[model samples]
Target: RNDHMLSDWFRKNQEVRIYLGYAPEPNWWSVADLVHVFTGKIDGISPSFRNSMTCKIIGRDYSAPLIDTSFTVAYAARTSSQIAKMLAGKYGLKLNITDTSEIIERDMYQNRKEWEVLQALADLEGFICHVDKDKTFHFGPRQESDEEVEAELYYRSRLKSNCQVDFEDTAIDVYNQITVRHYRKKQVIEGSAKNDALIEQIGQVKERVIYNSKAKTNAQAKEMAQKLLPEFSRYVVTGKAMNMAGNPNLFCEKKVAVKGCGRFDGNYYVERFEHTLNSSGFITNLDLTNLRPDTAQQYRQDLYTKDSAILGSGNKLGSGTI
Candidate 1:
């Protein structure tokens, strides 16, 4: 099954690296976004604590440049999913767009890249895009669950090293009034959805500029601003958690609770995560943010309900009574 998915393009373009582990089995291969280009030992040194294998892993998104193909798009009224499909189709990539946005009279020039255009559309609609393990491209919000804390990490106990949190209040990140100008349209659209909240917190007016978009109406521009306001509200708390034990389920876009510290003890969303395993031990590092979940998605709750029903039912093993 896996061999069938590896086409001639992938075999020729994708990088391959061999890692010799303590096993009698043959080499294990996986198609990740990035792979190891080189792996071996240091110069004039045998395998020891300081002389581990030196592996260079490159990012898997080498195909990003391929998606940078330029083309013109003159859209009168088009949904974001349709535009995304057109972009993904250019590179023979599959898209899993769970949400959509709308645009009117959008025009794309030859200079702009398809990835950049896709990112712009995603930003306008509060969505994200990334390729998955199965090479399926996903476009949607970061999925969340009802669980208050996805995992727990202690500072001096679970963590091998120290953890630090930093606070930022840059004016460029937060704004009250945002004026957007279309590339071709003559009208200027202003969005002040949370003006009162901004004044109450910062006690002053902060203006931001968002110009040269493809929006064709005041409504579309306002919608873009409305979505951008919450994202740019600059009261961000970010931190680095180092040397935690390995957890397979921990990754970006998940929430975790941090304690054992006076000032930085709170719930944080994982912005980045990396886990590595070797002969020594497993290490997990995390980059977390203060963005909390607004509400749990319905699908997540449905999964819990199904789990409870299955566990509570007292039927035999294979009675087909799930």
Candidate 2:
């Protein structure tokens, strides 16, 4: 009869292949025994049958299995039954009462320690509710409602008070639930406006000149001065001279006062025309007319030579006499 039942299950070649790979042990007891043992049915079996059962039953009056290997067949059967049940539920398939009974029996015969752990986890419920209503499962008020101002505080208190729960695990559970509910909505609404405004404001700010003014050493100061000189050149003597002397004119056409030149004199002095012109502005002539004849001629020659060389190199002389 068992062989006929097996043959009926494997009418198709594919089914036969599957069955060949999954051949049940000949020595194995029927699913009834597994289900009975799984559901605390050790006493239902005769003394001889119980002794022969692969799993070593242990513990006081309750014969819990000491060896895990004995429950292997039972565990596999129970898991397979659970999977079938889940598939049936998902697809709206009709499940037989006999199949359900077999599953229950198998589960009862499984290892007690593992079964206890599975039951504990199955019974557990996290405090926080997911934001997505469809995904959320609500239990009785564990601590507080989501709308309550002090809900988090209350929930945290309950979690800490639960001796069986670890603080980190509880916190993680609560956080995951809350985030799933609120994070997406908050990002779509509040974040959108803030992000748009920030980008728009940045676009409105004008890009103008930038200055760094903490220049300290002489080299740094010189670089800063060079940069500033062009902007302020219109208000300075160098710019005035450059404006007066156009092309190749080696001297200023009009008289301009040089400030901060002397320790004593505050007035401008009249002098003959002798200055060098270049792109960097103007180099004024040093007064040598009042000096001794030989010394004055030597000084004038030296000035001419230096100014010629500077002009030939296409350098701009600043508004200062040598």
Candidate 3:
């Protein structure tokens, strides 16, 4: 009978609520703000013998419902920045994208969520997409700088409870040969790009092939391959570290440097970042990836670029991997 009663009680208290105050006070704000709802399952419950129940929580984005919409559109010769504006119009969102001269020849987004479509389009140009605190959509190139506060890595005293370092050297997917086949100008055009250094190091015959119809010509396919080859020709570095600073604004797709650790000390891009805020404090867990190799990050300024012929630029527009 006691076990049954306890189970009933546990189920009742699992209801979700927004807490504003700490214990011994009028916690769990009686008048909750639905606009700023923190939606998550009640993970745990503990009573401190004072009729006060402490709730363990997981943070969730409440704005997810906004971007979940179906749409279809055909775009031509539109830069990433322009596409961002068109998508953001549905939600009256202000679009802020990195300045780019790269232009898409043609793109068709079938019936899909605006969020998913935006991300897919951005990936074609090696950009990241996310909404910021101001509710602005940031669809920009991966800002690969160590100076930005959002991109800087804190070491020694800044790391909180847990820190982990990992690396994968035997990346079989890292390919040196790329063959892109497409139909153009009333005929089939084929182009290939190869990483000479990777071929020399691994062997001459390690080939990986792909078919891309996005590029209008054989030269465009070759250019696309050149931009992509460097990104795949490397072992991926990933790790998770806690940020004691509690920067609530931190989101995924930002870069950070991992210093003090030998070999692991390099610039890494955050693929996933989860920020948890509670009565204790804010804790951040990061899934990081080193897009560029150690030496490449320092000296390779023009990593990828748009063809001058397409954009009418005398020089190549800066480019990088998605």
lDDT of each: 0.50, 0.23, 0.51
Residue 179 in model 3: lDDT? 67
TM-score, predicted candidate 3 vs. hidden true structure: 0.53
RMSD of every candidate to native, in Å, equals 14.4, 44.9, 11.9
Residue 201 error for model 3, in Å? 7.4
| TM-score winner, 1 or 2 | 1
| Best candidate (score: lDDT) | 3
Q: Write the per-residue lDDT of candidate 3 for residues 269-295, one digit (tens) a residue.
A: 654555556566655666565654222
lDDT of 1 by residue, 1-322 (tens): 1233222223323533332222333375443423322222112212222343333323334335434476465555566677777767665556688645444346542346776666565544445555543446665665655345778866654544344434332243355665554533334554444567876778887765554234567777778767766754645455667776666566555778878766667787665566666666656677665644222221111112222222232121111100
lDDT of model 3 at position 2:
35
Error of 3 at 13 (Å): 22
lDDT at 226 for candidate 3?
Answer: 78
Error in Å for residue 25 of model 2:
57
* Model 1 regions more than 4 Å off: 1-12, 15-57, 62-68, 71-77, 98-101, 108-110, 146-148, 156-172, 176-191, 194-204, 207-234, 292-322
